[model samples]
Target: MSAVLDKPRAKAKPKAAKSALQTRLDAIFSNLKLGQEKLQLAHQSVEMTDPGEAAEVLLRTVIEDMLPASIAPMRREPLARADVDAAYTGMFPALAAMEGVIALSIGQVIEATLREAFAHLDAANAWMDFTEMGDVLPHREDITEADRSDNDLAARQPAAAETENVAGCIFDAYERTIEAFAILDSRVSDMNSGAAYGARSLVKVAVDATSAADETNTRDNCEHASCALHEAIEVLTLVTDEAPDLAAEGALALLVLAKQLLDDNVGALP
Candidate 1:
């Protein structure tokens, strides 16, 4: 009786392995669902904010949060907004001088993030495939023959559609993320250009306002144009301070890379 019971228990091993593989596949689907929900929240956040504030918030978010979340931890501290801005100011003879450097550096960051994102995506797909196919490992010949006819037929028909749907969802999330990053890059470029031009314009306005002040350069109540330009500058200052969430995600990711580089070469200037 003991020998017979042991024999039956041994035969149940393949079934147990198959059940484990199915469980893993379920977990993969659960994670995919959670990822999709997070993507939706990100999209809603972008859609809700005003453009300038949105841009600033996005920039801050990328630099401070999203990047760190994405990458492996580094020993060095990430570059803060003050650090990047100070670097921007110091490196440029004028704000306009920063155009090329900002474009190139930020562009590279965007590209690298997209590359890493795709790599992550491919890894996820590989895992999903493993979970889906692993059950056949034990009863290879029988499973193969059975799946060959049945799965082949279904795979060519409904299974193909199902696979495409899953792939589409995955690709859609990735594409949207990349697009968000691109928008952020564009926003930063625009904001920099606007600030440069605005600064030059403000200087001219100030000079005119000064000249008009009593002709002796002593004044009390400011003129209309100067006051307006000053107000504009204030708005821009607020913008710089705020930083948009979408841009923040990308910026944070770049800083994570920067942190890694910094950690490897300690005490090096950024």
Candidate 2:
């Protein structure tokens, strides 16, 4: 009977304003959400997607933080026409200024890519909305060769043709990734001794890969080295807050790795 009588008392309890500590906690959670949003956007710009920090691994996957360490290697070669073509032809239909041929030099190819990047920038700024990309932009999801369907190649000819802007997003993302890697590569000092040692090991692997005499084997080894350096970039990207030097060192190591690959294979260039 006493328990039943307490129901009326519970209903009569008055609501009260939040306490000072509760208010402070609310503000903290709001700020955290906003910070999380900005961080996600940064990832989208560089990685072409936002895998939000659902876990500790996701927190450091952001390329913007890793960029301070990777810039040098990204600019080392500036993506020769062959390298551009090798990396993107499957998705881009063509990697040069023309169809079925690579007549444009590396300078021309890189300039064209930059032009697309600037145009995208101009349009986005003019509209005052960066997210208004105007079309289905490139994402890492579309990067694999197997993802390049017959439909993409049939979309347009001369991937850089002025009549269509299909390849704009792909080239822009490519340029940004290069810039991020380059920036990170140039500031590679103050790294932890252990991380420095690990980076050196990657460099040694690239050196050994470059020393291969057989053409096919050399190219295969270079491919593996590129993948390894990419993984290193992903790893160092997490050290942006605690030990940025590690991130920078990793970026520089990636540049060295790329340089070795290009230098070793220059003989194959057309």
Candidate 3:
């Protein structure tokens, strides 16, 4: 009887260990950490020195945020070509221009502007990533196909519908960010063109205004033009604010960036 009791006790320890492993596996399967991980990865990816690295990170983030949880269960694509094309179109040009400016500019002013622009881009990307992730987590398969499938499916089954809606909102935010970047790029181009004819040096830029009235006009026009870039950024900021899933730190990063660019350019105006 003692021998049998000892054998059962030894077997019980193995069963307990097996049960613990199963419990851990269940916890992992039910975990909601994917969303957190996606955002964190997006943040880190943006910090990379290489533009290619940054771009890869951005692309991976978008895919991760958009992908459904159970790939084997649902055979649908995560993102449409049109949506992917639009997103790339919006971000790539500005990203390239930022890289160019970083290479070209020698002084502190350019460095500061470059820093601000990248910071804003990173923030905007992170916010979008978060919002998109909010959409398709719990009922991952059904929620992601919301745009493609019937409204009845989405409306009748409301498990992850809110998450899908949040994803849509995130897409909209990125669109607005694209618009803001366009505005900034165009404005900067105009400024460079204007500068080409106006003055070569800071002293010359300042001295170009012969009288107080001339100085006022030059400052007013250039400053307003430069400030308009920030106005666009402010509108983008508002769009981000409208998103319920927006990260607060990400939003603040954008504001800090916009203010820095506006102040730098406006201050440089003669």
Candidate 4:
């Protein structure tokens, strides 16, 4: 009778369902990880003999496959404030790597792919709560450090001129402008504001102009790139006015160098 008096076992608690935002964040992080792995594999196995095609394939994978897949869930549920910074930071390495590849690869096809990718990224930014994210410059620094570390092996080899060509210059300028934009975007309480959208549109135009310049090594294209980059600088000034910081200053300086390189090369061109 005493043995039969053993207390009944407590019912197990049901697991709490993950919030939509958490689910979306998990999807994004998973896709990014998978995309990075694919990128690494492509880097190792794919021959650079056909760099243009290789670049196109890689860009397509990120833009069409990875990016869309990641952002699709976020469209349904806004990303949590705590998750936004990590999302952006996680995406940067892949996008930055693709940018470098795009700079190196000579072709017209990659331009459309890049524009599409940027558009997706811009849309994803709409889902983020930048106000709660606070300062994102440190995330940029993390990206820079990762970049430097990744290039450590390459640093042992002969140095490549970063702004050797007009396309390279445009990409360099684009990179700076985007970096500054990220700082501004993070600081802004409302990314959906007209001013923020305008700044983003300017950056998109700059990207389109850069793609145009990259498509063909022509004086006209170079001039277009110069003008677009200049507009980007003006936008950057607005960004700096909104949020003055070292990152913005540094971006402005580098953007000037990129523009100068484009101008010098354009002038030298017949």
Candidate 5:
């Protein structure tokens, strides 16, 4: 029995190397990848053949690929509005020299956008005026007159319609403005957040009001318009909050640009 045991039962054949599946799994794991050895650099050049197209791509990147929230720097601590005014005041000339007609055209479109923005304010005013009339009892004059009447919110309705046009123009302006920057081989990333928000606000008004007016009645249009204007106002206020340093400056710059394209004249609030 001791000799037989020592013989190891004729060498209990060396345990099978491994199951086929086990061998394959081990092979796969041996070559499996977990992490990159190094980060690859992105292309330095813009990919679009057209500069305008390139700009559209870049602006979208700004609008969509926002900096991580952890590092975003927008603030609202009462910065002087003058800072915005001053920034573009001096930068326009430099930009104009570098970007030429493209720059000027962007300014003009932006000017139009601003006026369109103002028009919405007027619409908001009209809507407010109409609503403020609030529950006045019909006078004895109502009994005497067969057809004496004033259209309710008539002025306000058209005011809202105007935003539809502005919305179209402002959307174009954003495209052109960034296109101009691309031509100059410059970046407008800093302005992207505020601009996108502001433009979207105005666009929301334009689209909401236009669609409702087209499909529904004037009263419905007014409701939509009012809501849109409120949203836009809030957006603009947020822009002021986020870009206090450049808000006034940007407005003033656009004003100068607008004046240049709109008319060659001067006026003051003395």
Candidate 6:
């Protein structure tokens, strides 16, 4: 007991501090995670609002608030040309913010993150043209029956079968895009190759293609959709070529499915 009491206790070692670079990286990742969460919340809010009500809600809650906060200051003083240019440039951040929200919403749709099928329904609405089709015939009470008939035909909504086909192509492409992103996200550490940014570039291409697909689908532009989906497939091919390990069998299968859908529907008018 006396010998044990005489033994000295070892001092605890101090924890090593994180390097400045590592600390910055940590902060960046944390901010990115927070940003993602915020985007998700905004997407949810958009989804919860009815399509008819969305415009009103957005105007009241977002645009109205922003206009006062951002533009009210300028109204207090007569703006010089320089001030006007500065204000114009400053609006870009708001534009970018809107674009980010829209992108995230589209991405979530592609990922099938939303529980409802309303997203697909909304996409399908693109094929339903509400406007009168064909050139505005001369506004005359003496319009011929043939002209009216042609106008009615031109204004007709797309054939259900055709709409379904295009929708299937878009859906398949979106699903594959989601898979592609999943693979890239898993291998984010390899996004940058020593000096080449092949993976990162392909990722951008994939995102752009998905966005194009969404926009074209909304416009019922099948040709553009086909091209976009083709680009998406090309991205998958690039991903496979650059990092075969990341191109899992499931992803390849989805790619094949997407390609088949596109092939079947290519050249078909919306």
lDDT of each: 0.35, 0.34, 0.35, 0.49, 0.31, 0.41
- Give the 10-residue window scoring lowest on summed lDDT in candidate 5: 34-43
Clashes of each: 23, 18, 2, 0, 5, 0
Which stretches of model 3 miss by more than 4 angstroms?
A: 1-221, 244-256
What TM-score quantifies how close candidate 1 is to the native fold?
Answer: 0.25
Question: Per-residue lDDT for 15 in model 5?
Answer: 77
lDDT score, residue 256, model 2? 37
User: How well is each residue in 1-270 modelled by candidate 5, as lDDT tens digits?
Assistant: 688667755545677788553453243223111100000001112223233443233322222221111011111112112221232233333222212222222443333332332233223222222123333323323422332322224323543553445333333333323332232223224456746444444644444453543344344443454455445435544554665423322322222232121111111101
Q: List the residue pairs that clash in candidate 4.
A: none
For candidate 1, give the lDDT: 0.35
Would you estimate the TM-scores of all the predictions?
0.25, 0.27, 0.21, 0.34, 0.23, 0.31
lDDT of 1 by residue, 1-270 (tens): 688766754334544445765564455445434433443343344336533333333433333333322321111123122322333232212111112113323443233433333233333333444333533334323445655566446435632443344323223222323333343345555556555345334434433443343132122312332353344335434444564333323332332222222222222211
Report the C-alpha lDDT of model 4 over 1-270, residue by residue, as the tens digit. Answer: 576678777899999999765565455555444544554444443334444343434443344333443333232222233335555544443354355344433354334444444444444444443555355323323445555465444433322343345456555545544443444344344434555556556755766665666567578887887898788778766765775433333334444544665676676444
Per-residue error at 216 for model 4, in Å? 0.6
Best by lDDT: 4
How well is each residue in 121-162 modelled by candidate 2, as lDDT tens digits? 223223222133332233434445544443345323422342
Candidate 3 residue-wise lDDT, 1-270, digit = tens: 688766754334544345543343243323323433443444344445433332333333333322222111222234333332343334433343344333333253335544554455544333323233333233334434555465334333543442344323323333323322323333333334433222122212222222221234344643443344344434434443453111211222323333333343344345
Error of 1 at 77 (Å): 48
Clashing pairs in 3: 135-163, 135-164
Residue 2 displacement in candidate 5 (angstroms): 99
